[model samples]
Target chain A: MSLVRLCLIMLALLALAAAVAILLGETPLSLGQYLQALTHPASPPGEVLWTIRAPRVAMAILVGGALGLAGATMQGLLRNPLADPGVLGVSAISGLGAALAIAGGLAAVPGAIELSALAGALVAGGAVVAIALRLREPEALILFGVAISAFGGALTALVFNLAPSPVAIAEILAWLMGSVENRDWTDSLRAIVPMAVGAALCLKAGRGLRMLTLGEEAARMSGLPMPRLRAYAVAGAALLTGAAVAGAGVIGFVGLAAPHMVRALVKDDPRRILWPSALAGALLLVVADLAARLAPTDQELKLGVVTALFGAPVFALLAWRAARSWRS
Target chain B: MTAAWTLNGVSARLNGKRALDAADLVAWPGEVVGVVGPNGAGKTSLLRAGLGLLPLTSGEARLSGQRLDQLTAAQRAGLVGYLPQDRRVAWNLPAEVVAGLGAIDLPEVQALILARDRLASVGAGDLATRGVLDMSGGERARVLLARLLCARAPLLVADEPIAGLDPDAQLLTLDLLRAEAARGAAVVVTLHDLSLAARCCDRVIVLDQGRVAAEGVPGVALASDVLARVFKLDGALVESPAGPVLAARRL
Candidate 1:
């Protein structure tokens, strides 16, 4: 399909996904009732729609979009298709920060989770930055991110096992697993500013990232400053990932899935894939949230689990194809 | 004409081993300088150091009278373009996109047009839209050559640029380098082909064991005695109608 047609399809799917999410929740509101709740705020359906579902939907979309754009930015900067916010330990660090806020009673204060998550993400992202800068070859940076991810995961598990209360343990586990079940507009409001700013920065850095696809020597000759550009991209990725994690706990595969799927749709042009990836990511998470809310099972699936279940196989297939293409 | 670059008492050492030892060289505007050496003779190291990507162990290299390390990335970019020995395209991005990236001010269409015009001057226009991944080795070389040209910098440093080209393409590549020099750009290329160096470069530097064994016009630098001692080959310089050529026998 042509790029324009593909973009139209992506947008249409997003709209459909949003509509389906609105109609399929546990409250079982029909399309008309949901429409009434959204358009006519004073009606009987207003409480159900405005109070609970709207915020949930908005939170899902915002967090998903953030993860998607962050993933795309990371992949482009690293020049490695497999790189993602979660895979580099950025999310784990953010989760640690959120857990600290909740467990330490900081969440009693308004807006603490967001600040805590941002701190965690910055710390984790900073470690990756330091390591990437230390390496001479780009491949070494990839390895370093992998190492950081593994170490971060271990640290998170240790912290969870040491929780003092059953409630604390459950919250930590739920956050680690990733969820959007009880999130409201406040969560989305908390994240929107950083996500928007970070995405804008990523888009501005898109041109430089495209030049870098030709390798460092070529990029330098094309007028890119290696050290500064690398720092800019890494900071952009961290901010986007940090905001998403702060708002919605730690959604794992959205970042990995969104960028890869968008690349598949748009042919790996960084400039073309930027916004589409964000939109598609928002769509995917909204749909996943809908499924999590209304599945036949009593226990709702976590948002992260749904994405990981769906994303891992598709991601593997794309990665295999990429490797084979490179080999040839 | 002003000197585009100069290296004085410069040396490069990697992993405690001397890669380039006390090398002194100067390239003027509109000059074609070729460096020839064996595999470990430090041709790539010298280019990297000169470009300020690598620091000199001692002494210094300068671009347009400013020390290379003192120049900002943009200032250096306006001064020099470097093509490393290995060029990789991480994705199957279109070739025109790659070349157009060097245009500082034009839109993509205008950049492509300007890049194609420059490529056409070097016999490389037809391959503009081809994917770098799908191209043949010679075709990739030409595309990268187009990319190098698009920089429009005063100095061009290409390391083993023609290693993958066919014989005919090799000659065209040399001609392109000559044309770049003729346009007032300082051109430095490292090559395994002595004949191409002898035919194209105004001056040649021959390196042996991390030091300059010979430096001068190609005919004088590639003399039989130097080739025999430094390159371990017995070579004769024969006067052709066009110029002097080097014919060598394996040691």
Candidate 2:
């Protein structure tokens, strides 16, 4: 299928998933009733829809798209399919930042934890980029990311150990598992601008990313400014991943899986993969969120938990195939 | 008149060892100059320095009488086209698309047409729609050569352009480079097959240990004494019916 047709299908699927998520909440509503609530105002159902479901759905799409675009950019910049947003240590540092906010009793504040997570992500991403500038090798960049992730993980553990209360520890742990639960318009608004900017940056860098598929020397010979392109790609990915993590916690696997899935369907042109991967990301997250809500258990499953459960096996299979090809 | 590309007193160190030591060479338009050397003799470094892809430690490389470092990246690309020794395609893009990458700044339609024409010139017209990942080494080399040709730069620098190709493909590549020179482009290619070099090149520069050992017409540069001294081989330049051939055996 053409890339445009596939993207349209993904968008339609996303709309359908959003409808299901809105209609099948704790107090289920029929299609007619939902339409009435959407069209009419000053009704209890309308109020519930506006105040709850709309923001949550918007957040899911934004976060998912952000992570997906970031993943695609990371993979292209590194010239490795195994790269993802988390590979740069953004998500882990974001988690550490949230843990600190929770342990410090700042969870009661409206945007404090989100702000902290964003800060942490930027710092980690910046550090990785600084190191990458000095060390141009892609493998070395990933190794630095691994080291930063370990540091962030250790920091989060220390926060857990020093938690003031068991309730605070539970909240921090649950947040790390990732969710869009109870997010309001404020959260959605906070994430949208940065995500838009980041996506735009990725789009601008897409042509260079495509050229890079020819390898660094060839791309440079073709007139691409290597240092500038690398910087833009890294910063764009950081913006996207940081914004997504701030809004919805550290959601796992969407960045890795969305781009991979889209590449399977479309040509692997890095420029061509950006938007479809974003749509696939949104589609993946909405479906995962819907599954989380529809599970038979009394409490909903975490979004990260569901995505990892589904995405890890697929990733493992891809890695195995890539390794086999390399060996042969 | 300024040469198409020139390296004057150029020195470079790669991985903490001297790769090019005050190497001086000039390539003019309307000629194909072949560089020949044994392993680790800095042929790649000479090409790279001429393209300004490597920084000179002590001297300058120029294009059209201007220092390479003084030009913008786009300007440099417009002046010199380069093909590295390692040909790697990370994805399964079509051959046409890969060739079009050389002229990425052009409009899609123009670039595609240019790519197709280049592929056809190199006898790779049938492989335009084929995936590069599916191509054999020789086919890939042809496609990549087409890409370098698509750049249409005044100077083309290629490292080991016919390394893995069969004899026919090797001749085809040499012909394509000659054709580029016929069109007023200066073609600089590093070659391992001395016989091909002798048969094809307008001039040959023999390198030994990061410096020029001998340079002139192919017959003079590949003399028996230079071959024995630089390559450690007992050899002679035999006059075959086709041309001068370097017949050599290990010492």
Instruction: Indicate which candidate wins on DockQ.
Output: 2
Per residue, candidate 1 scores C-alpha lDDT tens digits across B1-251 of 66888988888887689888998778998999999988899888888878876778987999888888888878888888878787677766667777677675567778888778776766767777667778877777777788788888888889998887888898888888888899989999999888788888999999887788899998889988988988888877777886666778878
Report the TM-score for the A-chain of model 1.
0.89
Q: What is the lDDT for B147 in model 2?
A: 92
- Candidate 2 per-residue lDDT over residues A66-109, each given as its tens digit: 99999998788767676776766778998898889889999889
Candidate 2 colliding pairs: none
Scored by lDDT, the top model is 2
Point out the worst 10-residue segment of candidate 1 chain A by lDDT.
A132-141
Q: What is the interface RMSD of each candidate, in Å?
A: 1.7, 1.1
lDDT (Cα, tens digit) per residue for candidate 2, span B17-90: 99998888999999899999999999998888777767789889899888888988888888889999978677
Residue-level lDDT of model 1, residues A191-231, one tens digit each, is 89988888888888887788877776667756666666667
For candidate 2, the docking band is medium
Q: Locate the minimum summed-lDDT window of 10 residues in model 2 chain A.
A: A132-141
DockQ of each candidate's interface versus the true one? 0.62, 0.69
